[model samples]
Target: MALAEPFEIARGVQTESETVIVELTHEGMTGVGAAAPSAHYGETTATVEAVLPRLFEVLPEDPHEIDAAHTAMDRVVNDNPAAKAAVDIAMHDLVAKLHNLPLYRYLGLDATETPTSSFTVGLAETGEMARKAEAAVEAGYEILKVKLGTDRDVEIIETLAETVPDARLRVDANEAWTPKEAIRTCRALDGLVEFVEQPVPAEHPTGMARVTEQSPLPIAADESLVAPADVPAVAEIADVANVKLMKCGGIRPAIATFHAARAHGLETMLGCMIESNASIAAGVQLAPLLDYADLDGSLLLADGADPFDGPPVPALDPTGVVGTGARRN
Candidate 1:
């Protein structure tokens, strides 16, 4: 899918997202999912496609046997979370449809307290980003996640704070800053932004801990926390656990990660890659479990670019839709 515009982060810029859509059929019903693989995570369209067939072979005949399916897939392969995520998501959609319940209701999550998702403003010139922030506010987004990595990160954010005074702001550096730089920037923007995300590289755990210790704003772990096993270390240094379906596998593993985060006393969040509603919809179903959300992947896509339709974003209310509410347009 083409982005509405170029979406830049610290790692680089993307103009289009190549996503693989997955469809699973059983007993005359079909469930849909998609894989929005990220090269940063060692996945691409080819990787996801290559691993899916082997993963599918392990899926249990019963869609309800999600645990067994996951176990079998893990035993078959090591770190193909995006591929596993597609199958995992499809199976979840199928099970919910068979039971005639919305995905969240099937999982027993309350819909009353779902958090509003943050619309992201990818990196751009200071003036351009400010314009985007103003447009997002005009479009009814009260919260915004501003991408920051440039040398003028502080200037960009300060301009945005002025551009949309009422908007709640969150900033993601996407592991762009050095430890000292992260700490300095975080302190500089303390009151202007909500929190800072992945300010330093994931490879430097000690540096991340140092930044976390010094930053005035709460820290959110994105690249630093990829799986449940990383939760304990993340909890020691970050205030929020940013869980993504692509990063941790899918709904089942994401749930496990969230539970582990909670047990370690960290705030839980759900983020997404630039994705279609096919996968983002599944993430929407789990919104009640989140303290914060950044599930604006479909919103960033060019209008009508996605082939599937799913739950509404920003509001992210999943009250009455059956299954994942994701299907072909």
Candidate 2:
């Protein structure tokens, strides 16, 4: 799908996110999923497509048995987490549809307990970012997640806070700052943002620890927390851990990471890459278990081409439940 506008972050700029949509069919029923490939994770559309035959080999004969399906997916591939996530979501969607329940409710979650997903604004000039901030607030977004990790981080934050003073704001540095730099930046951005995300490189937990210990604002770990096992190490320094479905493999692993992070005394944040509603919907299903959410990838997509005939871009209901999953037409 095309982006409503080009999205820029510390990493780069893009006008669109390309995703592979998948369909799982059985017994006169069908389930759908989408995969957003990431070069950071060493994944691409061609790579994801290459793994499909292996995924098909382990296709769950019984979609209702989600656990078995998930395990089968885990066994099918070693590093194609996004591809595994697509198959995982499709299996879960199929099960939920068969049970005639929404995906979150089918998983026994309290839909009312979920938090609203944050609308993200990628990095840009101070004036440009503020304009995007204004548009997001006008469109009913109560919380805004901004991309930082640039020299103008503080300036951008100050301008955006002034532009939408009432709207809650958060910033993701994406591992751009040094230990000392992170501390200084965090101190400067103290009241401007709710928290600072990945202010230091993922490779330096000690730097993150130093910033977390000295900074006034809470620090959230995005790059550092990749799996359930990776949670405890980062939780030692970070206050919040950001869980992305694409990053952690899929729903089952994401749930595991959330619990693990909580066990280590870290709050949870549900986030996503530039993704379609297929993956965004799966993340929405898990939002009830998180303290924060940045699952607005689909909202940035000019079109999701959502084959499921559901609301692809979420409404940012800070108080209500958002629906998810796909069905056969």
The residue pairs found clashing in candidate 2 are none
Report backbone clashes per prediction: 0, 0
Please give each candidate's TM-score: 0.99, 0.93
Number of the top-ranking candidate, with TM-score as the measure: 1
Instruction: Give lDDT per model, in order.
Output: 0.93, 0.81
Name model 2 segments beyond 4 Å from true. Answer: 303-323, 326-329
TM-score of 2: 0.93
Candidate 1: residue pairs that collide: none
Best by lDDT: 1
Residues 1-329, candidate 2, lDDT per residue (tens digit)?
A: 68888998887888877788878887776777878988888899999999977987987677777678667767767878888888878877777767666778777776576677789988888898999999999998989999998888888988998899999999888888889989999999887889989998889988899999999999999988887789879888899999888888788889999899999999999899888777777777776788998888877767534333334334422223232554323
